[model samples]
Target: MALWIYRRLPGAGAAPRPVHLAHRIGGAVLLVLSLPIAYHCITAYGVQMDSARVALHSLAGCFFYGAFAAKVLIVRSRHLPGWALPLAGGTLVTLIAILWSSAALWQLAQP
Candidate 1:
């Protein structure tokens, strides 16, 4: 969050790139890290459509991937409007926040 905000400062105009290679690498690492958890959840729960928590996690994971793809696309596409980068980044942040609150926090609260 701070990184994104920092990049938005008035002086940041000199560098038009929204994300560094490191940021993209970190996101790739996170995506890889999530795969095991997702696999375990699917193998264990088997997509419980009747369970909102499970369904939400599943949906959020799906959206996370989509957001990630969009972020990458936005980062690489020069023809997009200036707002596109921030919007893509914000969507990713929102999805991660939702996933954290819904899944990570829920797991922590469990006995």
Candidate 2:
């Protein structure tokens, strides 16, 4: 996120090829590392909406992948508007934050 923001800054100039490479590598690593957690969540509890918090977490979890797909598509497309990739990336990040707060933090707060 910080790298994306830095790249977006007005005076930051064009990001070097290595920076873009690093960003892609980081995203791939995050996706690979998240698979086990996603599998556990889906197999263990499925999509429970028994409470508001659970519902938010479940919905965000579901949307995160869709957003990821969109971002990947945006990255690969040649004709998309300039803002499209950033918008997709931002949405994914927001969903991650929501999921972390709604699920992980909630679990940590349990007695």
Candidate 3:
């Protein structure tokens, strides 16, 4: 959707149905995939703050869902400004990157 939005300016035509479909499908898939990881993190670790990295990861994990909910609301609402969706989406992507780096990247780097 980001790519589509970026390219869809300055007289670009309306997006095809498949593009919209793909965006919704992708969002659903991502949400489904994230739930398990979130469940495990909350149940197993429960937001530890023993170290800087762990704390950042935990905070990011917690905020990610909130951001997601906000984004969904922005998408559903008609009163919000046009930029709200993209801003919330960008925030979510950044949080996902942070979570990936702090958890997956850190684990991979271990000896």
Candidate 2, residues 26-109, lDDT tens digits: the string is 899999999899999999999998999999998898899999989999889999998887799789989999999997798999
State the lDDT of candidate 1 residue by residue for 1-25, as single tens digits. 3255446565654333545555667
Stretches of model 3 off by over 4 angstroms after superposition: 5-13
Tens digit of per-residue lDDT, candidate 3, span 1-111: 655745756566667778878888899899999999899999999999999999999999999999999998998899988899889999999999999999999999999
**Top of the candidates by lDDT:** 3
**Backbone clashes in model 1, listed as residue pairs:** none
Which should have the higher TM-score, number 1 or number 2?
2
Q: How many residue pairs of model 2 clash at the backbone?
A: 0
* Poorest 10 consecutive residues by lDDT, candidate 1: 12-21
Q: So what's the TM-score on candidate 1?
A: 0.73
Each prediction's TM-score against the native?
0.73, 0.86, 0.89
* Candidates in order: C-alpha RMSD to true structure: 3.6, 2.2, 2.1
